[model samples]
Target: MASKPGILTEWPWTRLGSFKYVVLAPWAIHSTYSYLVKDTTQRDLSNFLIFPMLLSRVLHNQIWISVSRYRTAKGNNRIVDKSIEFEQVDRETNWDDQIILSGLLFYLASMYLENGSHLPLWRTDAVIWTILLHTAVIHPFAEHIAYFALFSIPMLSTVFMKNISIISMAGYLTYIDLMNNMGHCNFEHIPKWLFSTFPPLKYLMYTPSYHSLHHTQFRTNYSLFMPFYDYVYGTMDKSSDSLYENSLTRKEEVPDVVHLTHLTTPESIYHLRIGFAHLASEPHKSKWYLWLMWPVTLWSMMVTWIYGRTFTAERNVFKHLKLQTWAIPKYNIQYYMKWQTESINRMIEGAILAASDKGVKVLSLGLLNQEEGLNSSGELFLRKHPQLKVKLVDGSSLAVAIVLNSIPKTSQVVLRGKLSKIACSIALALCQGGVKVYTMREDEHKKLKAMVSNEAGHNLILSQYGTPKIWLVGDGLSEDEQKKAPKGTLFIPFSKFPPKKDRKDCLYNSTPAMLTPKHLENVDSCENWLPRRVMSAWRIAGILHAMEEWNMHECGNMMFGIEKIWKASLENGFRPLTTSVDPKPN
Candidate 1:
């Protein structure tokens, strides 16, 4: 919102929230139904085109947003180094409103225009001379006048030029929409050679840096799509060319650390930092509209498979260290497939090798990317490339510390789940700390007993009888087993993913995560299922390893000191969250 939001700042559908598009549903359905039902010769093409035109504009803008965000996060060829706060992102969310408004205005104007339904896209009618004359005379006035006056261009052009067509006006509006998104994309993509080769092109085309100056300076470079008028009136920014040149010459940044992760759900793609602005800023969940993009989701999966490379999901700076989050193209479901095991390991190995070659100090695996069943928690990567310098971490130690700290100071806690390294570590640590670890199954107890000492063995008792208030859980925690727990039992998860909330009566703690330090820059998006600005213990473990200049690998069977990591986290300004869980309606 603006300092004081008014009609200009807020949209008419502001109160509708996610269902704001419902306002356009009637028009869309009617147009789609009409177009399909009617014969080509009998169809009202102009009316039907309006709805699809709006959709095209939306798709066009979204392409710019996703590409711009992905490029900017990579920090290569970025125009403005200034951070785009959530306020800017939230404001940009409504860029579609202009598209909707333009379509509506075009439809209204078509009603009055001569032979509007049969207007050709372009005709070398005598209207060109009139358009040029009006642009030269009325353009400067419109630029200085109220912004709403800019809307008068299409109306004024059509009123004067009888030969002008709706399609031609529509084409002009599309040009405006394209230039608007491109100017604010915050990246330099236009080649400088074009302007040098044709000096006149400099006056005709405005670079991203040129418009960036108008936003920062607020008094220069006011031209909408052309720099010609701005130059004529002495409003062109002086630093525009310099910023453009420097932005183009900017070098690609090599991060100090990288976190390797993968997508969870089909909708998880939209939750990425480079995806939708509103969706990315919140905890990941299935949006009602995502089902409508089933085709896009499938297409994205295919594209990822074909691309066969990692992409930057997020980038951040903590103190002097540059951190990046790179995601493998595979999804959680694909990782569980036997057919995908070799392919998945190959990608992980490639990423590790690339990070080592780039002089990255640490690279951490997240989500199913580090599963023991898949790669023995990243153990396979080391066997293939033992001489790599980049320290690979599974982040299990910090995750263990966070889960341990989240548990209340109870004498006994129920431990249940499929046996994993994290779960085993938590059970043994609790036992060694004199906390009784009760197990329900004999097999799990025997497996855990083999991993612990005789002194701590007594603390690990086989009994599911008591109503333990604290339950240390992991994957394979079924709803029926959850029902067995007493009401008000606090379930603390030791895994990367949270369990399904089956018992409302039972309290569920989120997967291990901690509040990020204030100095962590560019933290606009939440990690999957974690609260806003809260970093998962596993993700933070890699960052800590990099910052501490640790020269050891924490992946595979290797481990770090739990207390050392926990103490370093606090010392480095990373605070603990009291509780983490999937956000639910009150």
Candidate 2:
């Protein structure tokens, strides 16, 4: 006697076994409605086809399974082997499965609508079936597709199949399947809003974030069509939204290490520690007041004093081709400020040590870690820790790359800061790219003009007379300076305050906080998640640039120079700020 085939071995075709009844039930109802109410002459012979289809479906599945097993034994079918391996890891219904499931439900609904018109009872049954099928099957399948494809497919299918009704439901199902496959292949172009839409469509349709939870640790989000089922059944996972947002915006291309520090203020730290204490004491049942309890605060403070040294949290390894992250923890913001250089250096050293220990290739500095000036350029850290082989990235190049990339090439870019080495480097790069560059810093203007004059003596007229759109880059613009900018002037903020609401047409926040997981998670709480997304894009671009160099030379030092770094940043996806001014004027 042979052993029975497990559900894992059967899959898609096996699904048909249970699903055939779903198809048959609708068909049976329609057949009865047609025979008794619609007309005696009109009989639904389609209902009888269910038994044969089921038998055929089983045979089809068994054949495929046998073939797959045979091919695996012979080692000639990599696709089947890979599918098996994938099943072991994921074990979830993929795009194809979703398509079949959605299609069956659509087909069932179409039958019900087509037959139930004559009887009031049958009409009610049709409505109930439609709701049940949508809630139980279509919604969950749509969600699965959304999470995997980032909400691109279902949105597209909805638009493409807008005119499709019960009469053309088959065509609609086919369109959805086609669009889903296409979206899965090219999901990067899908708009971010599709993923971040409020009241998340996980239950009604699908949401990337909601679906992402199903892929990750939580498996309770089992409702396919609408989250209502999950909520009603108490199977809804609360953290799905945050996890999904993190998946979309976080640097998934490069191996990223999150350098986290405690909140600076003693009061804040006390509160945070107390919160942690409460969480520990009550596990998932901790109350809000527990975080403010004096006993909890005292215990937290005592624990911090005893063993709050910088440490490494768990190395978060993502599944399905996602980046691996090592979360490096440090003291609060105020601790570094109070101790100054020594504390900062210790934190930097700890990050490096932890990263090196975990075999992390690149170490990303946390917020304000670049401040206090210890390893702002990573030159100091490299010099101090010669033995450590990890590359130190302050995320400045990536940040600058993102700002330049966001500004349209047609816009005239103004570098407003005093001509520091970094600013000069940026200005020079812009000039070389042939951007019509301007500057508020007179000294830097003179230097840039001289450099431009020296580089393009004859081409100077091109820059002088070009009709370039003006832009302003600074910490923040003064009220007087704000008046100087044209109505549509774009403001790119570096370190200074953000532009006033009415001051600029658009403001780009290139701050490091935009890229932090904490900020990305709180996207719903703010007016926009664009800044955080930009940060994430920049971080990914920088990491990719580093990855390419590291892969070739086993180190990212190749991008140490300003020119090399700038060029690599451009290649990694940041569009060049400067365009070749047509010396021959139009």
Candidate 3:
């Protein structure tokens, strides 16, 4: 015998709750059509034919709410618990905002398609001419001007006048919202055989079991209308069927409420995971060494083929500290050289995937990962994985913070690098701190000199100034040039390379240089706790600082100062690590 449909899964009238909506639906449609169209007699016949479809839109929310209430009242304890958990997770993560945005996009697409047919056949030539004029003469702004003049202004006037367009738009938005809500309600009474026999039906309408997986495991099944978008984006969860079955059939009692925040315990804390294109200690630039490692590289490739691209190092967890780290291994330099364009990107994507799997909140790019040609503040990763929940951070602000704090007040310093974004930020901070800065870049030096000279009551001269007390060598400086600094000068190198042992002239090294294995060992007893392996820690700290102070969303390339870093650390419940101080002014 076929089991009867549950209250939530019954026929359309029962699911809709009130019979009053059914009775009034015909009258509502006729009234709306009569108000909008002049020829009521012709439109009334058409409206009568499509009255059911129009009525469905008006009562969608009411039906959804009725079904939801029925399910909550009749479902087992475990089912109710799962529903509550889903709601909590949705609220805490702000997933509803994303849903609304996606719905708006769908609405815009619908509007565009509808508008394309609204014009008459005779007006097609005029439309083409207008497009050509916009393309050739107006260029980029042409589209913006056309959209404003043609659609936006007219739409505004119609909305203000309370026309048919306004009524239709409201109905469309409400329909979308109700459909999205319906997709989330996990009614277990849906027949599996219906979906199994007609797979394409799943694309047009979501089954309760199908949409349940989206709430539980958020990295997949993003589309509300159909599975088509999910399939195209490669974000459809394969285990959705099994998971849904377990949710429906499980006998064990589950917790009534499960917040996503509660899941972030010490054991499952979202790691600030970091990635690198090449290790700092490795000889990445040497072609001969790279070729020599080809055999080992081939073996690694076989291993990757068998397992996967990413190889995870043991998790680094500090007992007292709330922070943890995960390092994802990438291909060696040989593979990168052989497949120059694709190699590093593949490694980066693999690392990001691994981090996302581990539930990482923030993934920081290290050293070579930030190279202009590579990830470049993780724009590529973001573009490729629009469904990715993990935040990508470049850690530029943290690097700047460390650099600024290292310099003393009123000290004269020489900057050895082309005036890059980071370098410019450092220069601005130095000037604010009453420090005189000299630069190796002649063009930038001239610009700085002129600016300083032009300032009223300032008597500082560039060429006539005495030797700088400190020399700060950035990533652009070569090893040979670093060795040429004057004797007894306080040399600070920002690049990954360590200073020579025989260099007795330099007084101190910055935090970036201290990330080396040897230097880290001297500072802490954890010889295996390689700081250089996770150099993005500095950047993570810096970005967190910026976020706290400025409420900045993207921190990939933003500049930060020491004051902001210190305050941000205090706010975020962590202490910023202090490095060795420079020598006192002679």
Which model scores highest in lDDT?
1
Stretches of candidate 1 exceeding 4 Å from the true structure: 1-4, 29-43, 112-118, 126-148, 580-586
Please give me the total number of clashing residue pairs in predicted model 3: 1
lDDT of 1 by residue, 1-586 (tens): 2587555555778788877777777766776697789887777666677777788778888899899989988888898767655666666677676666666555665556555554545566524643463354222342212443564565456555665555655565566667778899998999988988999988877888888998899889888667889888899888988899999988777999999999888789999988898898888988878999999988998888777588888889889999999999888889889998999898888888888998889999999989999999998888878898999999999998888887766788899998888899889899999999889889999999999999999998898564687888899988888888877788888878899999887788879899998899888888998878899988999999988988899988888999999999999998877854422311
Model 3 lDDT on a 0 to 1 scale: 0.45
In model 2, the Cα lDDT at residue 259 comes to: 33
lDDT of 2 by residue, 259-357 (tens): 333333233332221122212112122244544466745665667555656532212221221123222233444434555566656756776676677
Runs with alpha carbons beyond 4 Å of true place in candidate 3? 1-308, 318-328, 331-339, 353-359, 383-388, 418-420, 443-466, 496-502, 513-536, 539-556, 560-562, 570-581
Give the deviation of candidate 1 from the true structure as CA RMSD.
Answer: 3.4
Task: Give candidate 2's total backbone clashes.
Answer: 11
Query: What is candidate 1's CA lDDT for residue 315?
Result: 84
Per-model lDDT: 0.81, 0.41, 0.45
The most accurate candidate by TM-score is: 1
**Which candidate, 1 or 2, has the higher lDDT?**
1
